[model samples]
Target: MILDALFFLVMAGLNLFFWAIIIAAVLSLLTGFGILDTRNRVVWTIGDFFYRVTEPALRPVRDRLPNLGGIDLSPLVVLLLIQAAMLLVAAIQGYLIRGGVYF
Candidate 1:
């Protein structure tokens, strides 16, 4: 039971982080298109918040990725990684169930 609860919690956390990344990516697009005014404090604050949240996870990927003339693929890569992690969690849960560990 405890293991199941912990797994649920971790899955929930991962799902939330996954959404955060999506939100950050969307916000980036809005900023890039100039539809959002970053000079405004509200816009700046929101943009900065997303940046701080995502940059840590994305920085290493960004560093490893070769520059492609202002195109950034790190967010897409991170999203793919997040999807893989979610799949991994589901696989582990299935494995435990298959092994007859009824947690």
Candidate 2:
């Protein structure tokens, strides 16, 4: 019972982390392309936070990936990785539930 609870909590945490990455990626793309202006202090702050948090992950990807004209594909690659991780987690959880395993 406790194991089941813990598994659910961990799954929820993963979902939250995944969504945060998605949000940050979107924000970074928008700000990078000038679609979203950081005119207001609050906007700048939020955008800056996401930029800093996501840069460590995206920078390496950007460096390895060849530039396609002027477009950046690093964020798309990162999003795909995040989505794959989430799907893998869900599949593991489903398997555990089906096997009647609490953990």
Candidate 3:
């Protein structure tokens, strides 16, 4: 029971992070295209929030990846990794269920 709850919590957190990455990427695009004005306090605050939240996870991936001018693929890579991790968590839960380890 507790393990199931723990797995659920982890999956939920991963889902949130997954969306955060997507949102951050879109926000970057909007800002770059001038669709969103950073001069606005609300826009600036939201952008800053996403940047602070997502940058730590993205920084290492960005640094290791070779530059492709304006194209940034780090978020896609991180999203893929997050999906892989979610799959892993589900697989572990399935294994535990099959093994009768979850009750």
Global Cα lDDT for candidate 3: 0.97
Top candidate on TM-score is: 3
The true-versus-predicted C-alpha distance at residue 79 of model 1, in Å, is 0.6
The candidate that wins on lDDT is 3
RMSD of 3: 0.5
Looking at candidate 3, the ten consecutive residues that score lowest on lDDT are 1-10
User: lDDT by residue for model 2 over 1-103, one digit each (tens)?
Assistant: 7766866787787666666678887787788789888897887998888777778878899999997987878777877887787788778878987897844
Overall lDDT per candidate, in order of appearance: 0.91, 0.78, 0.97
For every model shown, what is its TM-score relative to the native structure? 0.91, 0.69, 0.98
Candidate 1, residues 1-103, lDDT tens digits: the string is: 9889988998998888888888889999999999998999999998899889889999999999999988989999998998899999999999999999865
Window of ten residues with lowest summed lDDT in model 2: 13-22
Candidate 3 lDDT over 1-103, as tens digits, reads 7897899999999999999999999999999999999999999999999999999999999999999999999999999999999999999999999999897
Candidate 2 lDDT for residue 20: 66
